[model samples]
Structures are given as C-alpha cells and as structure tokens.
Target: MSAPDPVRCAVIGTKTIAGQHLPVLQTLPEAEVAALCDIDAEALGETSRRFGIERTFTSVEDLQTWGEFDAVYVLVSVLAVAEVSERFIRAGIPTFLEKPPGLYSSDTERLAEAARETGTTAMVGFNRRFYTCLQAGREALLDTGDVVSVTVHADEDAGDKWFGEKFPPEVSMRWAYANSIHALDLLRYLGGEVAKVTSVVRKRRLPKPDSFSALLEYESGAVGRAIADHFGPKGSSHWYEARTASAVLTSQARSSPGDRLSSCTLERHGREPVRFGLTGLDRRLKPGFPGESRAFLRAVQTGEPVSFPAPTLDDAVRTMKMIDEITGAEEWAPKPAS
Candidate 1:
C-alpha cells in the first residue's frame, strides 16, 4: 500500500519571524513547506531558494489559492495579523498565528468567531510556554502548590533601526502590544489567569513607546510583576525569575536575533541561598520554530494535542484586552513635570 501524503504547509510573511517558521516546517516529518509568501519579492525569493521551497507568491491571497496547504503559518506584522488570519480561516484552513494574535481585542474576536464557525484549529504562537525551563517550573509549582509571587524581567536591545523604521510615531504605541504580550501571557501561564493589571509605560532614548512595567493580580490570589524594555544598550540581556514559597527560579542570558537564547540558570531555594550554578541546554529551548511546527503536525495527524501551551483565540483576545487596559489606563497618565 502507498504511504499517506505529507501535510502540505505554507508560510506567509517571509520576514525574520517567518525565517523561523520556514525551518521549523521543513523539520516536521509529516509536513513540507510547499509555498512561501511575502510582500517583498526579494525576501520571498531569498527564503524560498534558501529553504528549497518551489512555490512562492507576493500576496497571501495568491499563495492561499495556489499552495492549497492544509495549514498556513501567519507570521506577518501586528497590523496584518488579523486580516491575514481571517482570510485563511474563512478559506477553511487551519492557522498558527504568531503572538499577540491581533492588534486589538475586536480583531481577535472576529478571527475567533471565524475559527469557531469553520471548525478549524487556530493556535496562537506564544512559544515561551514551551520552554524546557518553563515546563519544569510549571510542573514543579503545580506539584508543590506553594507559588506565591513571580517576577520577570525581559529586556531587548531593539536597536536604533527597529524603533525608527519598524515603528513610526503614529503606530509606535503598539510596541507594547507586539512585544510585551508574550511576557504578559507568561504571567497568565505561570501564575494563573490575571484578574487585573496595574501598569505604567515610559518612552526613553529612542522615539516611540519602548518600556513598561506591570503588576498582575491573578485569580488564584498570586501576584506577579512583569517588566519589558526594548530601549537598552547593545548586547543586553533577558532575565526571568519565578519564586515560590519553597523555591526560586531564575534565568539570565543574552537574547540572539529573533530573541532566541543560548543558556539560562535554574535555581532552587535552600537554607542559605545556594546557587544551582549555570547549566547549558540546547541553545534553542523548545527547538524554537521546528519544535512548534512538529507539534502542530502531530496534532493534525493523530488528533494529539499541540505540544506548546498555546493560547486559544479567546485567550489571545483576552490578553489583548489586558494590554489595552494597561496602555489606556488613566492611572498610568504622566505626572506634571516640576
């Protein structure tokens, strides 16, 4: 008997994030990167050639029609996320949209409704929840039931060009939406769903919004603090810490392009402050893009669950709502200068 055909997949948005998606799809034994699409023809051709993808298109609509893949990885900009996602959903294709899901709750809700009506699998890409350290932390905390507070610090050297050309003044406010949503989602993943958030945003150094700090009150009576910054010196670091009554977990490492990392520290609380020391795991925790792609393929083939702790469309919408609250809060208004 002939073997079953591999799952045909196409990647939309051939940017840096799309670069991550392409490799992941190629690694999946049950999936193949059948097509690639990008507004930039140069990028489209480059990625297609590099990845050995034969079909390429400059428009998602064209790609969708020609490629006819079972699923599409939507990795475009925040502004384009919802529209592109809705298009595929209406076309009856499952989609794995990169994080934030959409620019606003309304857009996300629209996509969510479409997914439900079409009965297509829609998963949001919040990859942090898939990390080995995070997975261990989740299991440890759940077993102990002693987590009280969690603190996280995430800093990105967005570089001058990122703030200047990537985000203009009019749309700069979305920096918080596009970047910090992952950290905010992490709070919900680790602590429990956030009940309320008090947040403050600041713009420093480069123009546009760049920094924010928030306090999250979780439904389980746990409190967490999250800080995200993109305006920092080059070679900056990403640090994350989770503490419970019985243990404390920490990771400090430099973030590479695409915010990937090399190493991290995991600590267990002891009588005097014993350090567990630094250990090196696979630089690509969760295998970054490839791991997620494999998980999606598995879910499709065997009816197994996706490996990552992904946000549903509804969960992503709610996270966007929380971001809106933080960004639009009256309490976060700037004080009068002396």
Candidate 2:
C-alpha cells in the first residue's frame, strides 16, 4: 500500500524548542511543515530562512486567516500555551502543543476541556515520554509482567538560577511544573498515576523549593519513588528504572549530555541482558523528535488516537496534576549556618 500523504504542519513559535522540532518534523515522511508563525518577525525570518519554510505569519490571527495548514504545532511561551492552543482546538484543527502545556495544571485542564468540548484532536509534547530508549524499556518491562515498581532520579545544577535570566518571575517561581515535569511525568507514563504519597521530604534553597524526594503508591498497586534535586554539579540529568517480576529495565534520559543515543538496558535472570539503543532516525534528529513528530502526524493523518506512549492533551493533564501534587508537598526550613 502507498504511504499516506503528509500532514501539513504550521509551527506557531520560531525559537529554541521550535527550532529543534522543525527539522525533525521536516524529516518525517508523514509531515510537511508548510508554514511558520511567530510574533517576532526577525526570529520568524531567521527560522523560515533556515528551514526554507515559505509561508510565514506574524500572528495567530493572520495564520488563521490563511488557514492553509492541516495541523498546528503550538510552541508558544508557557504562559501563552492555553490561549493559543484553545483557538486551534476550538476551530476543530488538530493541535500539537509543546510541554508544560501551561504554567499550572489548571491551564492544562482548560485546554483539555476545550478539546473535549470541540471534539478536536489535541496532543501535548512531553518529548521525554517519546524517547526511543524509554519506549523500548517500557515495552520490555511490560512483556516481562506487570510493573511492580519504578524509580526516577531527576536533578539539575542551579535550575532555579538557570531560568532567572531567560524567563519571567512567574515561570521561575513555578520551575518544577515548567521544567521538571519532563522527568516527573515519566513516572506516570511508565508506572501509573500516583495514588498516594507514602512520604515526602522537601528543601528550599531559593524562594521555591529546590530539592524534593518522595515515595508514592500507584493506582495500579505498584510502588514508586523519585528524588529531584537542583543542587547537582552537572547541569541536568535523568535516570529511570522500572521493574516487573521477571526483568528490570533502566535508561538514561535520551537528552542527557554526551550521550549520542538513548542508552537503555533490560536485565533478566538466567538470560542475557538486552540493550535498546538508538534507531537510525534517532541518531539523525533530536533523540526522540522523529518518533514524537511521527506519532502526532500519524494521528492527524489517520484521525486516530496518538500512537502509543505519545501523550494526548488529556494524558498530559493527568501528568500535570501528578506534578502539582508532588511539588505541592514542599516544606520550608532555615538554611544551616555555613
């Protein structure tokens, strides 16, 4: 059978993450980035020139007026995600939103409700959930048996300070939801929704808590634990592990520095371990971008649910709620005298 025609995608932001996603979307056989949009003309021009995207617009109103693309990728700032995405969703156009989906879970809730009310297909980009390594590890774990436990380690050196120069005070104050959700969401993607907080410890180094550790019980009867500290010497890192009765699956977040491919290993007793390394496409594009873009475009083309593991807006809402609960368990204490 012949392959389906590509979905025409119009990207709504032209900086940083959009820059990373554009090339990957172009590389997908199922997608064609037909238009680019950004309020900043210079950034839009630079991205349009860099990617050779000819159709460009300076505003969502202008893009909607043109209305030529089949799907839209809302890569706007964290604060603007809901407002921008709601327009596309309510218009009945397939919408793909970049992560954090909003500054808070409430924003995600608003988008989810809009999607349901309009019966539009909307997905949120939780790129880590699409990492090839994590996908392989998850499949292997599920094959072994029901997942009994999961452990995730997420840390960033000076994360609170890292965003100070780049984002507004509001975004900086809600740092965990804006950024750490990338790793924390993995807990739900791999294990399940956190049913209860078994225990929690939090430390505030700055205005917001900078370190957290928690034990959780999942709705699936599985147990999970996570430790997130922003005091590491390295910039950022994530480690994931999930266990079943027969095997253990572990992975280094695909975006980790110095790793060209997503590094994953599945170990089973009385059998040789299996390594789930990068595919050719992963090596060529951002580690997970090809899979992520393909998943979204596939859903747009077939009018199907997003491919397995790629989060729809509703799934992202769930992840955001979990993050809210986890980060809400913060505790403040006076610093020890040095």
Candidate 3:
C-alpha cells in the first residue's frame, strides 16, 4: 500500500505571527511549509530562505492557485485576513486563521460561511487557552460555583510600530483589538459569554489612544473587567486574574525580551496559585504553535472533534462587537483637552 500523503502547508503572511507560525510548521512530521506568501518581497525572501521554502508568491491569488498545500496558516492582519482566508477556504484548503478573524463582524461571518459551504475545516489561533495554567484553571472551575467577576490586566510596551506597517492605521492605536483580544477570548473562555459591555478609553501619552478599561456582564450572570494599555515605560508584559466562588486564577506580567508573554496563574480560594510555567516551547521546536497545529491536523486527519476554550469565531465576534459599541459610545470617549 502507498504511504499516506504528507500534509502540505503554506504560510499566508511573513509578519511577526508568521515568524511564530513558520517555525512551528517545520516541526510537525505530517506538515511542510511548501509555500510562503507575502506582499512584501523582502519579507517573503527572508522567510523563504529561513525555512528553505522553494515556492514564494507575492500575490494571494497566485499562491492559492499555484501552491500544492493542503492547508494554509492565515497570519496576516485582521483587515486583510478575511480576503485571503476566503480565497483559501473557497479553494477547499483547511485553514488556521489568526485570532479576531477580521476587523468587522460581517467580514468574519462571511469567511465562516465560505468555510461551511466548502466543507473546509478552520480553526482560530487563540493560543492562550492552551497554556498550562489556564487549562488547569478551567478544570478547577468546573466544580466551583458560578463565576462572579473577572479582572484582566494586560500591559505591553509595544514599541513604536509594534504591529508592523501592514495593519491599517486607524485600528493600530493601543491593543484594544490586537493584544486584548487574547484576554477577551480568555474572559469568555473562563467566565462565559459576555452579554453587555460598558467601557472607557484613554490616550495618556501615546499619539493614539493607548489605554482602555471595560466592565463586562456575561450571559451566565458573571461580571468581568479588562484593561489593555501600551503606555508602560518598561518592556512588554501581560497579566490576567479571574475570581469565582471557589478559586482565583492569576498570570504574571512578563513578556519575552522582544516578544509578548501570554502566561497565567490560577489561585484557588484556599490553595496556592497555580502558575503556568514559562512556555518552554522553543520558537525552534515550535512548541505551542506545533501543539495547536498538530491538534488541528489530527482532528482533520482522524475526523475527531477539536475543542477550544475561548475566542471561537462566534466568541471573537461577540468581543469585537462589544469593543465597537464601547468605542462608539460618547460616554466612553476621552474628554477634550482643556
């Protein structure tokens, strides 16, 4: 009998996250980074050479039509994600789209519809749920009484141009969508679906609004609060904590030298706080990325179901919708300078 065909995979963008994705794909025995696509030739060249990829395409159409990849990792900006993802989904390629699928709800819904119609499997890159501490936290919450309130603190000194030049200028201010999206995904993952939100935004020192805090009410009668700020003078960082009738979960605020850390700690009411140790998943071994990638591939390969903790497409849409509402409300806007 012939050996099963290898899973050919392509990376759709060469940005920072792609930096994360490419390394991981290399570790999967069943997967290969067959193609690299990016509008920037220089970035494409760098990635192609680093990964030893022979095929590189500057256009999405060309890459989608010419590549032999069975799956694609869509790691481009949220604005461009829908367009590129739709192309791959329509082509019958399984996809692992980066989180917060698109800048708007309509776009993400359209992408979801395309995936459904074409029978293409898709997964969102909400990586935090896979963190060891968080996984244990969820297990702890199962027997604990209903969650009452949650507080998430995420601060990153994302230097100038932290997200790179590809992101649309308007949405670049602060990490309301970029960084907090992860926490927002976690909030829903732990506390339950958010039913309403009231928020306020501030731009203390940065050119764009760089700080925000919100109050969230969940469908399960739980309450949540979240803060995302980029005004720190120190290096990048992140922290999150959740409170329930039985326990509390916390995460240290620390990011890698150049990369943001997404770690957490879960503190039970009467027990010690459980810390998800530094994810030793080397960028070389592609630990976290490969872990999620392999899980997705296994689900596709075996027809088994893959479950996610938070920020599913639907959950992300709900979070984005809440952000839109908070950002648009006159009461939530910053006051005019005196």
Candidate 4:
C-alpha cells in the first residue's frame, strides 16, 4: 500500500530543545511545521519567522481554534507537560511529547488515560533509544543471552542555576527525576520493565541534591545501576553499559555538550572489541533529532505504534512509573491549595 501524505504538525514551545526538533522536521518529507506556539510572544514570533511558518500562537486555545495541524509536538517545560499534553490529547491531535514525560506519576498516568479515551496517539521523546550504538548494542546483547546487569553513568554541570527563583525547592530537589531518567528509560528500553528501584542521594553545593546513585531490578531478571552528578567539574555526562552472559555492550556519551558525539564499544569473550561512533548515525539508525523524528513519522504515517527503536506513551509511562518510584513520590508531586 502507498503511504499517507505528510502530516501538518504544530509544535508547542520554542526553546533550546525545540530548536533541535525544527531542523529535523524540515528534513522529513512526511511532516511539516504548520504552526508554532509559545507563551512568550517574542520567542513565538521569532521562531515562526525563522522557520517561515505562517501560523503562530501564544496559547493552545488559539492554536486549536485556527491552527490546522494533524499532529503536535509538546516541547514545554517538564512542569507544564502534563497540563499541556492533556489539552492536546483531549483534542484528538496525535502528539509527540518531550522527555521526563512528567514529574509526577499521577500526571503521567492521567495523560495515558486521557489518550486512551480520546483515541489520540501520544509518543514520548526518549531520544537515547535511537542512538545507533545503543540500538545495535541492545540488539546484540539480547541476541547473545539474557542481559544480567546494566550500569548507567551520567553527570552534568548545571550548577546552582536550576529552576531559577520562581519555582519551589521541591521542584529543585527532583533533579534526579528530571535528568537521570534518560538513563533509566534506556535501561527499561533494553531490559524490559523495571521491577524496583532504590536510590541513595547526596546533597552538596547545589540548591537540591547534587548527586544520586540508584539500583534497579527489572522484571526480566536484569539488574541495573544509575549514578548521576551535576556537581561534576565539567565534560561529564551519560554512558550505558550492558553485560550479557557472553559479552558486554557499552555506550559513552559525549564528554562535553559542545561536541555531538557518543561511542559504543562491544567486547565478547574472545573476539576483538568493536567500537562505533554514533555521530555517523543518520536518520536511518535514528540517532539524534532526525532519527527520532523519523521514528515518530513512521507511526504517524503507518497508524501503528513503534517499539524497537521508537516508543509510544505506554513505554514512556512505564519509564515514568519507575522514575516516580525512585524520585517523584507523593512528596515530589504538587500539593493542593490551602
């Protein structure tokens, strides 16, 4: 059968991460940026002009009324994702939501429930799954044997600049849930659902905790460990290492944000170590922005959910469940008014 026409898409949020998404959509023949939305009128106007998008709005209400788009991408702040996504899902517009899907399990659960009832498709952005080395490593690790253990090491140097001053301290303390989730989600992506997670955190110079280490047990009998620190000097980031019965697969994140590079190394019992530069991964491997966008487009076009290299809301919710288990318990969720 022939494919469907390109989806006219609306993107909410015009910030740093959304910037990464723009070029990708421009490259995809199956999708177009039909509209743009942001609360900040200046950013909204600038992004629309820069992208040559004729439609722009400052709120979801305005976008829904006049914006003609079949799909939407929610790139708003983590705190805002739940409320924003609920609106889109209820409107029956298929959406692509960014990572740290929601800070609260309740919020994410509500989103899943709304999507199901509304018959709206929602995908969570977990871009790490598209990294070629990680993808190839996951494939080989599973093929070799049961994945016994996985270890993720990630660090950043965000310093004391988190949340600025407007947000409460509780939001600041959820640093682990906000960032290290990428590592945890990647573990679940390869090892199946997580059964349990225990975390030990240390607070240092930062407003919230400065570092955290966690141990996770997956339902597939695979165990995983995650260690993250924002207090690191610099040139610190994420890496995933998976060990199967016969071999071990490891992926290293870029040493610095200025460089777009990640390396994957595979070591078998007696074979030579294999290394791959994920920077070489194009849209085909689904590495970075384009790869993920391509994955989203596939499901949007085929009307089927993708799991291998791409993921749906179900996968994202499960990851969020695990994240809430470790970091965003009731204490982290928002409280009622007085």
User: What is the alpha-carbon lDDT for the whole of candidate 3?
Assistant: 0.68
What tens-digit string does per-residue lDDT give for candidate 3 at 1-338? 75455678778889778887776777667677788889989999998888788899999889866867778889887667777888877887787888767655566777778876877777777776666445655676665767888776656665454556755554455256665666656667677778888877777766666677889888988898877666667644555667777776666545434333344566666776666553445434433565678767765665544556523455566666666654442233322343
Output the lDDT of residue 87, model 1. Answer: 92
Of 1 and 2, the candidate ranking higher by TM-score: 2
The RMSD of every model to the true structure, in order and in angstroms, is 5.2, 4.6, 4.8, 3.0
Q: Please state the error at residue 7 of candidate 2 in Å.
A: 1.1
lDDT against the true structure, per candidate, is 0.67, 0.80, 0.68, 0.74
The worst-scoring run of ten residues by lDDT in candidate 3 lies at: 329-338
Q: Please provide TM-scores, in order, for all candidate models, with all chains considered together.
A: 0.82, 0.91, 0.82, 0.88
What candidate 4 gets wrong by more than 4 Å, as runs, is 1-3, 163-171, 253-261, 279-287, 332-338
What lDDT does model 1 reach? 0.67
Model 1 RMSD in Å is 5.2
Could you tell me the lDDT of residue 24 within candidate 2?
86
Of models 2 and 4, which has the larger TM-score? 2
lDDT of 1 by residue, 1-338 (tens): 76556778778888788776665566556787778888989988888888888888899868866757778888887777888989988877778888767665667889999988987778888766665545654665565555678776656666554646876432344555566666666666767677888988777865555677888887878888878777767534445666677676655334434433222344455544333321222243233355456556666666544443666787787777766665552233221233
Q: Could you tell me the TM-score of candidate 3?
A: 0.82
| lDDT, residue 149, candidate 3 | 86
- The regions of model 3 sitting more than 4 angstroms off are 1-5, 141-143, 157-159, 162-168, 206-209, 253-263, 269-273, 278-287, 303-306, 329-338
Q: Evaluated with lDDT, which candidate comes out highest?
A: 2
